[model samples]
Target: MCRTTLTLGLTGLALLHAGPAATWLPVVRRRLPGLAGAGDADHVALTFDDGPDPRSTPRFLAELDRLGCRATFFVVGETLARHPDLGRRTVAEGHEVAVHGWRHRNALLTRPGRVTGEIARAADLVAAVTGAEPVWYRPPYGVLSAETLTAARRRGLRPVLWTTWGRDWTRSADPDSVLATLAPGLRGGATVLLHDCDHTSAPGAWRSALGALPGLVARCRELGLRVGPLAEHGVS
Candidate 1:
């Protein structure tokens, strides 16, 4: 009976930790606009994850500069620690740097206290490198657990998930494919997810997202939408 009780308790804990992950569902995201990163009707929030990589991130920076647009780069803590110059450059380039956790591991699968500590550590690293406190936190793979939410709150970071993604991490992804995947949801008030590096994806897959930048920005302008970072997105 003791073993049975212990098993039940663990299951309950897992459920509680994973329940908020339901927000990943399209319907749930549509209903919870704020959590889904919905913002101003005339603006679109451009967010990139798993980055500050030396291999591919600089190319993304150059592309954004060419387009005259800025985006939020959700960087991994450990990666940023290794490339503090990249982090500094990101900020200096008129882009916003946000937390993508200390590592890219999902919060639900991380051991207790690990996710919490990492969130704080990552936020601190961003502040240390950029000299500005990051205002947003996006969990790796968009999974948010109970502890993840608590940690974010304690750090004064607001959790945000994207409304649409380019699926640019796939091995088959390319510029046109990335644009096509994101086309349906490209609208004002939509948060579009792209990746700046392939740290957790098919090697060199970031090219798809990089190649799509110009077209994406052009398409948004055609729709009379403004492309910028989440700070300008007016999330409320």
Candidate 2:
């Protein structure tokens, strides 16, 4: 009976964790009220979230520089506070820096006023670093509420969503698996979601998503896809 209970508990936890990725709303196809669909042309936009880490972001930027690609980075305000120079470097490298919220908080859980504060504060910080307010906002974990969207719009930012996600937040995520997840929709106008930072800390630590970069970029090139900044596709 105890073993059975343990198994059930583990199964429940697994389902709870998997629910977010499976049920996340696809915001890419949903048109915001005010924006016109100029649409993307012959290119895919690469975006990274929950970032500005000191250990991993520099390497990610270096790889982007080497590949001659520019990506959109959605940075958390608190993390930006901790790594201000890294945020500056991201802009200096010609990548777009957008807001991921303050403290990586779930937008759904936050009150409208609080959400406004979180987004506005983050946008201000990003502007301070890069000299422009962020024009795009991607909610943490892809969770959103109507209030979140309204607040973002009022701030003059558009809610940008992903066409593909790698679940790169997982420590056990295989680079090949990440590649496979993104293989199908990797045509023009695709926004690929990845992470430049892993919050986990361990000896000989792994940055699972960052590990998948070279493989993913090579695959994009092999398919004759252009990878560039999200703004180029008129995402905002």
Candidate 3:
């Protein structure tokens, strides 16, 4: 290939890998609400990622029960495979189970074929373990490549990113900080992202999210927003 042609090809390839990640931007979320998991104006979608952990996921399940709320748990396939019972329990408890990829690796860094296989594997494990067909896919780190989108489509999983996140993965995070970080985006139609386990986070970081759950649900109810899983969020 000529120098100019090769340059153009490289640029196009780069865009293909990173372009869709623009959805993570606020302007993109405003423009493509469905992609951002924005749903009914009177409801907020609650989602958790990197879970099915026996060490901490059970606690989240208990807390959700106490709050009388249902949230979506996006499980890593490898992790869920080890704790299939936990996956089943999440669904049995009235929560939704979705795919968070086979592992917590970013698609941007994975080869297309590997990303494709991992997504499919994760989706299959979710269905097999929970007996519920997963409906959504959230790439690790909220980064999406062209391959990630294609894999999700092929598996019939709608790609969703959060409208707001608790930043609770940090060791420094606390209930107050998680709530405050999410305060601005705590609105009707927002998809709230949190972690039920700390597999890919600081040890015990999940506690921050756990601590914030009651207050988070309360604040949403205070604003007249129904808090529930994405399945009930009415996302397009």
Work out candidate 2's RMSD over C-alphas. Answer: 8.1
Residue 218 of model 2: what lDDT? Answer: 82
In terms of lDDT, the poorest run of 10 residues in model 2 is: 30-39
Q: Pick out the ten consecutive residues of candidate 3 with the lowest summed lDDT.
A: 1-10
lDDT of each: 0.86, 0.70, 0.85
Predicted candidate 3 versus true structure: per-residue lDDT over 46-165, tens digit per residue: 999999899899999999999999999999999998899999999999999999999887666676589899999999999999999999999876666667777898999998888888
lDDT of 1 by residue, 60-124 (tens): 99999989999999999999999999999999999999999999886667899999999999999
Clashing pairs in 1: none
- Of the two candidates 1 and 2, the one with more favorable lDDT, higher being better, is 1
TM-score of each: 0.90, 0.82, 0.90
lDDT at position 154, candidate 2: 82
Residue 200 of candidate 1: its Cα lDDT?
81
Error of 3 at 110 (Å): 1.1
